[model samples]
Target: MLTRDEALTLVKRHVSEENNLKHMIAVGAVMKELAARLGEDPVKWEVVGILHDIDFERCTGLTDHTLIARELLKGVVDDEVVGAIMAHNWENTGVALDTRMKKALVASDAVSGLIVAAALVMPSKKLAEVKPESLIKKYKSKEFARGASRERMVISAEFGVPLEEFLTAALEGMKKVADELGL
Candidate 1:
């Protein structure tokens, strides 16, 4: 399995936008946390999270969102990792969410944006100040963090994680890297 350092290097090489990098890092953190809670390999899950959006800039639209990353990582990573990445974009990729890791990826991807968006609107603009209750409140408002799909976030249920618990876990995960996220 690829280490965090190597995965980060790959992410930096392919993704140049500042916010995009932060987004990927946020997802990576959440994935690592979720993996630990789910009794999976945190490192591998972190690598999958880090590399999931490596092709965002290169690929456009749902059909292509994960295609380039899939090709780029064809031989370097395991099929399961690639599948999880592709599975995150399953609506367009047509890949089945066959694994818990895949479901966690989909659940983690947009919820990170929701949590980050919540922090951005805070007076302190600090993740430390963002609470689970605040996330729950923000999640109820569709206007808040419009890009973050409520349906997608709710998919955490399929992973056997309560939506509240998943949000709390994701919030804590993002909090760990608040400095890197500049939140």
Candidate 2:
């Protein structure tokens, strides 16, 4: 049960992009929060999120995003974490069906991007300035936040959380360290 701090430190040793690193951290926080509420292992989920993009900055082209990460994390993290990381990369790893861990990873990965985009659009351009209603509107726009997958964000419904509620919770989780992330 590696802590999120351990995972972050390990990832930073291999990747250098500040923004990509921050995004990983933000997703880790959201995953930890969601895992806690879902009665899952927060540390494991957080580690999964933190290391999911360990090779994103290292991959040469767009085609093998998850492959690089998977290869890099091979002997480092636990197998379950690796699976969650791959599960989030549907384009590369294919959809991970009938698996709660995979579904949870997909949810955290997708929703975190939407929440961050909402923060970027805020007047203050800060995570604290983002609101739940704004997230919901963005979630349904389909045309908005073009890279965020609304379908992946559907995992929120599994826990009886409306998209807005899930967004708020996920945002709050990341905003806890907004200054650290510079977002």
Candidate 3:
């Protein structure tokens, strides 16, 4: 398995956009929290989250997203990590959501965007200013963070976590790395 530092370095090599990098980091934080809650390996989940979008910048289309990442990460990370990455975009990549990690990855990926958007809209523009309740309120508004898929965010519930609890975990996770996210 790749260490977190090595995975981050590899991500930086592929992702040039600052927001994109921050998004990946935020997702990794959420994945770590989710893994802890579900009794999974936090380091492995975090690394998988960080490397999920390793081909985000190079991909030509939505369908090509994780497909390219599959090749980019081949032999560098374990099959489970790569499979979870591909499963996050399963609709496009045709990967099965056969594990809790894969389902959590999808929710984490979408929720990170919502949490960041919520923080940005706050008066202080800080992660500390955004609470889980506030996130739920923002989530109710379909117009808010439209890009953050509401459907995907609810996938956490499919794995036994309630929606609010999942959102809280995600917010707490992102709060731990607020400075890195520039939130």
Candidate 4:
């Protein structure tokens, strides 16, 4: 497995957009926290989260998304990590979500978006001011963070984490990196 620094270096090399990079960091922080809570390897899960979208800036279509990531990450990370990245985009790629890590990756990816959207709407525009309840409220209205699929977030249950608990962990995770995220 790649060290966190190496994974981040790879992400920076492939992803230049500021917001896109921050989004990866946010998902990674959340995945680390989720892994800790679930008694999994936090470093591995976090690395997977950070690298999941390394190909996003270069991707041209749904097929190019995870497919490109799989190619770029070959030999740099384990097959499981690569598979988790691809599994996060399972709807388009047909990869089965067979592992808890994969399910958490998918859920964390969507929840992080919803959390950021909620924080942006707050008066302080800070993750510190954002609450899990606010995320819960926003989760119901599809208009809020429309790109953050509620269906995907609800998959947290598959990882043995309740939806509310998952959202709270995600919010806390983003809050942990609020300074880096400028949120």
| Every candidate's lDDT | 0.92, 0.79, 0.92, 0.91
**Cα lDDT tens digits for candidate 1, 1-183:** 889899989889889999999998999999999989989899999889889999998997777989999898999899999999999988899999878999999989989989999998999999999999989999999899999988888888988889999999999999999999999
Q: Please identify model 2 stretches exceeding 4 Å from their true place.
A: 158-162
Segments in model 4 whose C-alpha atoms lie over 4 Å from true places: none
TM-score of 2: 0.88
Clash pairs detected, candidate 1: none
Could you give the candidate ranking by TM-score, starting with the highest?
3, 1, 4, 2
lDDT of 3: 0.92
Judged by lDDT relative to the true structure, which candidate is superior, 1 or 4? Answer: 1
Give the Å error, residue 94, model 2: 4.3
Candidate 1 — worst ten consecutive residues by lDDT sum?
56-65
CA error at residue 38 for candidate 1, angstroms: 0.9
Measured over all alpha carbons after superposition, the RMSD of each candidate to the real structure, in angstroms, is: 1.0, 2.1, 0.9, 1.1
lDDT per residue (tens digit) for residues 1-183 in model 2: 567778888889878989889888888888778778778888887788788888887777657777888887888777777777777777766746446667767777788788778888888889878777777788888888989888778777875556666777787788887987888
Between which residue pairs do clashes occur in model 3?
Answer: none
Model 3: residues with Cα > 4 Å off, grouped in runs: none
Q: Give the poorly placed runs of model 1, Cα more than 4 Å off.
A: none
Compose the digit string of candidate 4's lDDT tens values, residues 1-183: 777788898899999999999999999999999999999999999999999999998899787799999999898898999999999889898999999999999999988889988989989999898877877888888799899989889999988999989999999988999998999
| Per-model TM-score versus the true fold | 0.97, 0.88, 0.97, 0.96
In the range 1-183, model 3's lDDT, one tens digit per residue, is 888899999999999999899989999999999989989899999998898899999999897999999999988988998899999888888989988999999999999999989999999999999978889999989999999999999998898789999999999999999999887
